[model samples]
Target: MREGAVRWLSPAGFFTMRWWEWGPEDGAPVVCVHGLTRSGRDFDALARHLAGAGRRVICPDLPGRGASDWLPDPMLYQPAVYIAALSHLLARLDGPVDWVGTSLGGICGMGIAAMAGHPIRRMVLNDVGAFVPKKAMARIRDYLGTEPVFRDIPALEAHLRAVHAPFGALSDAEWRHLAETSARPAEGGIALHYDPAIAAPIRAAEAQALDMQGLWEKVRIPVLLIRGAESDLLLPETAAAMAAEPHVTLAEVAGAGHAPALMDAAQIALVAEFLAQ
Candidate 1:
């Protein structure tokens, strides 16, 4: 894998967004974005697979996660800032690139893809839809504010295993890999890498329904919506409506809840085939 960085401007100033590049530089580009609180490294397994098939896969670390810099103003950690930063990153890439997003990343992609002059040619939104239930959003907000430190990697892995159980039947090795990538040195022990302050907006915001159906209707490009069979964020009716729309295909994965870890062969294949088409 090759490492690259792009400077993106936000309200607080320009922050460098780091991305891992794979496959031939001239190959068709595919940008894979991770979920809230997840780093770009989460796409490693999927990236390798797409790269092997001669696709140039670019996975970016959203600000406050992975190797990206934390925002000076914690309140600036909302979706607008993320969308602006990613737009800059997209500007530096070849036009009409394919996008694969999970959770928060999916929202960002949907926002951009709905624009009249969007650079994305096709999209894959995994485990997130037009609207997220208040219950699920609340659960994420509650957990996101914590700065839990683990005495060891194993302990950290265990915590992730429980919290991310919805990511579906990940292997023991996969759990270990996630723990290793997500941990950072804390005052006394290792903790999840993202800034706890990133949750400030979520905690401070008024509770309300998140509706994005308007934006979804604006995206005319082909879209593949991957929903976890048991996902709370993307309910059955919403998924069905999204599927009913033009150029949208819904695929539900069994044995997963909030999101499916695209690391597995079956999950990765779903994304690969759609993007290939």
Candidate 2:
């Protein structure tokens, strides 16, 4: 794995966005973006799998999460901010790239793919859609801004298993990996890697409704929608509606709830097949 950073200047100031790379430099580029509160490391297993299949996989830690710099103004933590950062990343790449995005990441991909002449040639949206259920939104809001301390790694892992149980039944090793990557050194113990201030704009945005149907209808490229069978965020009906689009392909992961981790071999294979098309 190779680690690098891109220098980007936002309206607030300058910051460095970090990313993990795999596979050959000349291989077709595939960008994987993580969900809110999760870092790019979440895609470690999936990135390695795709890279091994002869694709250059780039996993970026969205600002405020993982090794990326946090924003001074929490208000800058919106989708527009993310879209701007993604544009910079695409500019750094060789050509149009395949995108795999989860939750907030999926929404950002949608915004980019909807643009004319966007660099995204194909996209895989994991557990997200034009219409997100308010119940799921409230559930995400419940923990987005919290700064909780863990006495030990085990404690942190336990908490993560509880909160993210919807990710489905992951192996003990997988749980530990998630816990390790999700934590950062803090006073007395450790805290989540992401900045809690990111929740500020999210909370404010919740006061209004998000209507992305117009944007969704504008995307011209092929899209693969990977939905958790029991997802509260991207409901079954929403997934069905999205599949009605000519360019959309839908896959529902059984046993998963709000989202599928995409760590298993089967899930990775499914994603690889879609991108190959």
Q: CA RMSD for every model?
A: 0.9, 1.1
User: lDDT per model, in order?
Assistant: 0.91, 0.90
lDDT of 2: 0.90
lDDT of 2 at 228: 93
User: Which regions of candidate 1 fall more than 4 Å away from where they truly are?
Assistant: none
Q: Estimate candidate 1's alpha-carbon lDDT, on a 0 to 1 scale.
A: 0.91
In candidate 2, position 109 carries an lDDT of 98
Quote model 1's TM-score: 0.98
How would you encode candidate 2's per-residue C-alpha lDDT over 1-277 as one tens digit per residue?
9997888878997888999999999999999999998989999999998888899999999999999999999999988988888788898995889999999899999999988888898999999998886777787777777778999899999999998899988999999999999999999899999999999976776533456888998887899999998888898888899999888999999999878999988999999999988
